[model samples]
Target: MSEKMQLVIDGDSVAFKQSAGFEFRLNLSEFPDLVKAHLAKVKPTANTKSTQACESLGAEVLEKDFEWEFLKPFIRDVCRWGGFALIYAKVLNEK
Candidate 1:
């Protein structure tokens, strides 16, 4: 699907354009800082152990990049629609 979304940043605008080739592009060279600020507003929540809520929200946020703000939402959307799971597993250390 080909779609275009416009985002206003720093009194300027960025055109987010996607094509059928699975290519996504952001055109806002004039205000990268604005983009960064916008992205920072969507930070991930702290790790949790609950199952139900964790699974739901995790699935929503997992497919996104940890640092790249402009690309995280789209990635997360694709992952969720694709039925991908997000896990937060960690090992413990013995003293």
Candidate 2:
């Protein structure tokens, strides 16, 4: 049997099963902090000043943008489908 987890965001509930070879857990309550950090890193445009600040903070502007773009579609698909099929598809495509 697979381990399952549930996450609730903004009153919407999502349940996910642990994917093969990837077993971990998340504390949903920390999601806000996670979002704050992600936003802080990715929200700014890639300017010389911003890039320097990001580098000093050990944050890579290009990398953050790339990661955000990569996850955006999956997030949209998950919200639209209300299931893990999109996630499975993404994982399958990566292999």
Candidate 3:
């Protein structure tokens, strides 16, 4: 059987699939804030505008054809308790 879980953060949901272990798949299409936060950390000098920074980073990721090594750190950080928990708890508690 396949096991999966989901948590909503900042009005957007991220899914975790369990095969051998949990694998995170983020839906950035719905969570611009998360993406922006990540970009700010990874590319601090790039842009002050969150939207623009996200777009630029998105382009870079796409240009690299979604390299896992390039994306893993960002994904790991965003999924961390300190990063997403408060947001997730707030959204979950509301429902």
Candidate 4:
């Protein structure tokens, strides 16, 4: 649950120390930029028609790969995962 995550705030810095060493860190000065960036990336949940399209593919494709540089910052915001995501629905727009 999101409630269990550790939110570390010291002076002007903000760092979220999440489970499994996944953390999101940002300085107080970066608040405006962080808000702007992630807001631009935020998206609404997928519709039913699109969810069905994801059935054709599975998580097996990514199960064997590991990229720390990308994963490091990515894990903090990776919700819908119970610590790990071995399978996920690839939401797509209806054709």
Candidate 5:
């Protein structure tokens, strides 16, 4: 192939009273390894605000509640496809 490609990863994590989940979306990018959404584009597509119903939360709590069983394989595949492990992960807690 004579062409190069770029990638962007968009991730969202939401925490509820007793459960939390994360979704990551990727698209072909015009910038290399773009990992964040712009200020105007940063919004949760999921109905997390209403569901959370919490004034504040913590990463440790969300991490404890997140589904690592599914997240591990997804992270593994992303790493394999990217041919490197330059991932920045954070537990998303809201206030």
Candidate 6:
């Protein structure tokens, strides 16, 4: 029998087949570092928009919503792979 891992997000469940084609196991609970690293990218951009605009015109704008901004790039990158996790995360409650 193939070993399967189940991931439930927003009441919907997805079964990841670990033995059929892939040999890896994904432990969502074990990704604290990954989560932290992703959140860290948003920290610098936490400043208010008015404060950011006061800087030079050529200066980069630190996105107000870090989580949302980060996902934009990620969604574009994963467009070829089909968007499952992005939708899943959008519906899931992190808090």
- The candidate with the higher TM-score, 2 or 4, is 4
Any idea what lDDT model 6 has?
Answer: 0.41
What would the per-residue lDDT of candidate 4 be over residues 1-95, giving only the tens digit for each residue?
Answer: 45467999989999998678888888999998976775566443442212222222223224425354433323322423222333223321110
Q: Please name the candidate that would achieve the greatest lDDT relative to the true structure.
A: 3
lDDT (CA) per prediction: 0.42, 0.46, 0.51, 0.48, 0.35, 0.41
Judging by TM-score against the true structure, name the best candidate.
Answer: 4
Writing each residue's lDDT as its tens digit, candidate 2 over 1-95 gives: 75655443334333344445443445667677987786577433322233234343333434566475555443444333333444655654563
TM-score of each: 0.22, 0.28, 0.27, 0.33, 0.22, 0.23
Q: Which residue ranges in model 3 land beyond 4 Å of their true spot?
A: 1-49, 73-95
Model 3 C-alpha lDDT per residue in residues 1-95, reported as the tens digit of each score? 64655554433546665555676767768577876676567542322234354456557667878786645433333334234534544443453
lDDT of 5 at 16: 24
Q: Per-residue alpha-carbon lDDT of model 6 for 1-94, expressed as tens digits?
A: 6476544342333334443565344456656776677555533233222222333211322444436655444343333223344554554344
Please state the error at residue 85 of candidate 4 in Å.
21
| Stretch of 10 with least lDDT, candidate 3 | 43-52
